[model samples]
Target: MSGHRAYTPSLRDRLTKAVMTAAGYLPGPLLRPVAGAPRRVDGQVLDPHFQAGLRVISLMSEGEYQDLTLERARSVVERSAYTVSGRKIDLAVVTDIVLPLGGADPDRADLPARLYSPVDGDEALPVLVYFHGGGWVLGSIDSHDATCRYIADTGRLKVISVDYRMAPEFLFPTAAEDALAAFRYVRDHAAELGVDPQRIAVGGDSAGGNLAAVVCQQTRDAGEKTPDFQLLFVPATNMSARTRSYELFGDGYFLTRGNMDWYERTYIRSDDDRLDPRASPLLATDFSGLPPAHVATGGFDPLRDEGEAYARRMADAGVKVSLRRHPTLVHPFVNAVGATPLAKAALSEAVGAMRMALAY
Candidate 1:
């Protein structure tokens, strides 16, 4: 990565960032009373700062994703990323490249990807093919740019953020196919991409995380090479059924049950699709021989239970796996890293694990 110009925040983005930063400094005693009684569930208490932040977020929200039209939902998510994503960290190299979609019709557009490296050089570095999470319908490379920059800079590795096609327009298997295609392209062309062929990893957040897990399982079943590691952040592992977390935290948290229902309805063609391993990796019967994995979940997130369950299942099948629950965190914590100290710490911890896993 070569030195690049820093990102300039819009006035509103700066204000939102300022408010979130200031909230982090407020005493828990002060926030708890203001945000209401401390919320404790599943033996984890919500962080007071996040409790206050969510209160403010709810006050400002016009509507949840379920209430908005497709175009409006997409626009809101894109804009929301800037408000919470923190300032983009400067990297040595950040460039955009097109990835050819494997097995797609000639007329279909190629995947758009952004490659991020912390240091500029010809060194063949370990690389992570990252997918942006938006419930399989809402995010983009640009939306996740700041997080990728943070991971590349902090983890001291290269990150290629894949802008896989989204739902309603593309649907479930399409995103999974694109994820597999992107990982294969990186592995096969590692030298050209300035990455080590033997050290490639696949990762993503939320829906993207689901895709990463699917890619690992898909490759293993097909007798193809799998990535060296998998990095999942607040991943939704099972779509077939809602877990206890959904009943506990789904409504009030940023990711609501209604919103999840909308995402699933839009991304999946039918109920049967939810049971497909590619759509719901947890439903897969075999987890043996999958690559080592790091699955991080928010204690308050609806997807937390499933993500942890997936990790445990993988471990039971003899795959080396680690699961870290950020007790006070919520879903989409990665986007808050720039403004939230705890969130930033959590991401750094996960990225640290990634670095160690891929270290030469």
Candidate 2:
């Protein structure tokens, strides 16, 4: 601890602090060297810097306290060889197709969506509206395309990944409503999109995953049969620091306590809204009658405990549930299918859960 690097928040941290102070109330890995590059699947060489970044994180976070920020979040991973190394990660990951939203509304939430469909489907098929994760700040349809494409091609389910309004600009329920609109639209044109009204689902990762959960609650409160299942990938369920997860694994993993503190402060503008169930599902009184759920968590992620607890809570309430944990992976590894070896296996398990829920 004596040789520890002095504590300093990253760029994302400074930005978060600036925003919070403006409001006046104040808020807020391992592996050994294996020579040139570790041999991995597909004959791809492991990025040495990634391992280096992990070392840096461990050196700094061993027993220290620091402000979390998206910048620091990126620094730990980006500093790795993945982004800094000379080699380009130009793998054609996946293809995206843009779809036009018909109607002369003149302001039809202009956007481009890449559709992924099941293997066989003649009539209406089950559709799953999705939102990508970036703490309600980062991430786009592009970042999550790989997972969507896999669902479309393998599960045979029509996966509609939505690009919603993010924060510091359009926080809180903005993304939630956009997700609901996409689902309602998908339901409205079930026949055209080849989607079955009764079989639609909603899901996403991290922040996106949180949105998916909110969408489910929104649909149900509106007196509608919610998505057949809610697939939350390492979702940030609670905004406040009341949960045991927040207290237990606050730091040390990829998703540090700092990263979360910064994210919640950024996403929630009105302090009153932080307690809203839509904003933080953990505060919701009722978990009954919600749709079935399949939640995945990375063992090393700070948010891991809450996700697993939510799954258990749903099961206790009689809602069907399955929670899977990837002990060796980080928060964003699920979609790094080609970049990380654990991705394929973990995603496959998730896809299986989806297929079972959709029963297609």
Candidate 3:
């Protein structure tokens, strides 16, 4: 009863914070209190929040990059949250093929994308360019297998899930560039790629959702063909540090404010970097002439307020906007698979939205 409230996140959130709090504070160098480091960690994984705090302090102390390294955080986060155990790639549509997009590093650079079809590669189908969520830090096409497959199989469309560049190493604009490059690649070879040029749409959840909106906005501005519709699932639309949601749910919902700080620091360079419209779309002055869009917000996400605000602003700017607020789920809950009922419902609604986008 103490956790119950007529608001997003609900008891689930209070419990997480309670747990984090129960863990007892560690010095600024042993965050999370893990048993031991993994045998072969490719990046830093904190056992304690303060350990992360220590790293930040040390970075500042050593005059190093005091900012967060999403790349480093992701190494630990994937182990806890984003790691997938079951099927990594499930293509329910026509037939699924995982193709390698051209990347500089064959082992690392060549982006891995999945092609989901409603039918054989012979027919043209409406296409969806999907980017998955992980705060641009973690998550891969494999982590979001079910959702993308559901979209292609149930929505009766072709889907392309992009494995965009993430943070720390290829920071901001790189992922954005990858998103655009993937779209352009799909557009340039629509016929050969088995897509209908006019029926293409862009979509993703959380960070991916942000990329989706950015893709559309950039397309319109660059005089490129716009996706028929845009689907944003609990998008992290505005990185501005001033949103009310940031103050409200910043410390809980399994996505702590510290975590966000970690993610954003990895994504952008400085406060001045926030000025880059590419970093925060809400910072953009003109939302006019962008494609019709649907922006979904998690009532509990720190990014929720900005997501809805962006949608309303879009509507006000004359872009066809459909906004839905799921006041019961937490950020990235859509990727929680079937664990949470609300997540299931959100997933269904997301597929339905994508179907609508293709229908139009």
Best model per lDDT: 1
- lDDT at position 184, candidate 1: 85
Which order, best to worst by TM-score? 1, 3, 2
lDDT of 2 by residue, 1-360 (tens): 000112334675444334322322211112334112342422233233223334443644423223445444334332221221221222222235444443576334544555666444465767778888777765566556656766665565678887776665666776666677676777777788767888888889988888888888788778976788888899888776555545555553456677666667777878887888878887777788889999998755678777887788778889988888776566665555543435556777887898888787
Candidate 1 lands at a TM-score of: 0.93
lDDT for 268 (candidate 1) = 95
User: Regarding TM-score, does 1 or 3 come out ahead?
Assistant: 1
Candidate 3: residue 304 Cα off by (Å)? 0.6
lDDT of 3 at 222: 92
In model 1, how large is the Cα lDDT of residue 284? 96
What is the alpha-carbon lDDT of model 3 when measured against the actual structure?
Answer: 0.66
Task: Give the per-residue lDDT of model 1 (tens digit) for 226-301.
Answer: 9999999999888889899999998787888888898999899999999999999999999999999999999899
Off by over 4 Å in 2: 1-31, 34-111, 118-123, 242-249
TM-score of structure candidate 3: 0.73
Predicted candidate 3 versus true structure: per-residue lDDT over 11-39, tens digit per residue: 64445434333333333224333423322
Best by TM-score: 1
List candidate 1 stretches off by more than 4 Å: 1-10, 25-34, 102-108
lDDT of each: 0.85, 0.63, 0.66
Global Cα RMSD, each model: 3.6, 11.7, 12.4
